[model samples]
Target: MIDVLAPAEAIHAAPELGAVYLSAFGAPGYDEEPARAEEFATEQIPLHSQRDDFKLVVARDAGKLTGFAYGFTGHRGQWWSDRVAAAVSPELADEWIGGHFEVVELAVVVEAQRQGVGAELMAALMTDLPNRKALLTTFADDRPAPRLYRRMGWKVLVPDLGWDSALYGLNLGVPLGH
Candidate 1:
């Protein structure tokens, strides 16, 4: 089952979360980078936890962390928002980037990939967002992550947003019966 963790709890479990992150993205070239995969798990995840609206979900199998997805409410002047805004027009950025939930990261261990863990983490992260919309960036190539995003109804907002990535958005209209 996937479990939601508060910011503090997520921080406390950073080692476990970092292990999952390393197992998921510890590919070649990543090791040569100064802020390598381990840094992401140790530093980046904790930084994400500092967001006022940060949310995290983890899937466990036999109590082992297999996957995770996390994000937070977006606002003007944020690093990600500013970067995306530069790649798109003001109107488009205003409509999609402003005040939306930003899905910063979603990853599953290699052993757990293609088994719906990523999908579940994504659905759970966006299911109850207070924001009416959500956005994320993924590799521009036809990778499994991007395919999963498309399957979940996310539309490409910027086809080539630099860094060989594309920006995507989803309208989380009023929930049923709301």
Candidate 2:
């Protein structure tokens, strides 16, 4: 089952969350730098959980973590928001970045992929969110992450941001790609 966890609860589950993150994102060079990946997950998960508008959804099966999704409300001064703001036009920045929810991370264990776990985590995290829109970035290559976002109605706001990353956005109240 998937459940929304408060910041404290999420923080307490940081180890499991970090494991899941490492399992999902650790590949190739990451395999050679496991400590770096683990360190990033350790630091980021708890820190993001502390944000006021932070939201985290975790999928558990028989008491084991299977997947997770997390994000926070976007504001002007945020590093990600500022970077995206500079990349997009003023109008688009206002429409998508200003007061939007930034989906910082979403990952599922390899064994849990293709079972709708990611989608469920995403839906649960985004549900009832007060933000009018949401934004996320993912590798621009042929990855399941981008496919899932497209299937869920996210549109490419920036197809390629020069680092093999693409920015995607979704208007909460509208149809996909609108």
List residue ranges in candidate 2 displaced over 4 A: 28-32, 175-178
Over 1-178, each residue of candidate 2 has an lDDT whose tens digit, in order, gives 9999888998888888878877887754236256755675678777777775999899999999989999998889888889988877888887787688899989888788889999898878878988889999998887888999998889889888777789999888874433
Tell me the spans in candidate 1 whose CA falls farther than 4 Å from its real position: 28-35, 174-178
Using all chains and alpha carbons, the TM-scores for the candidates as numbered come to 0.91, 0.91
Q: Which residue pairs in model 1 clash with each other?
A: none
Model 2: weakest 10-residue lDDT segment is 27-36
Give one digit per residue, the lDDT tens place, for model 1 in 25-103: 7744234243465687678878888985899999999999999999999888899988999998989987997789999
Position 171, candidate 1: lDDT = 82
What's model 1's lDDT at 109?
87
- Number of colliding residue pairs in each model: 0, 0
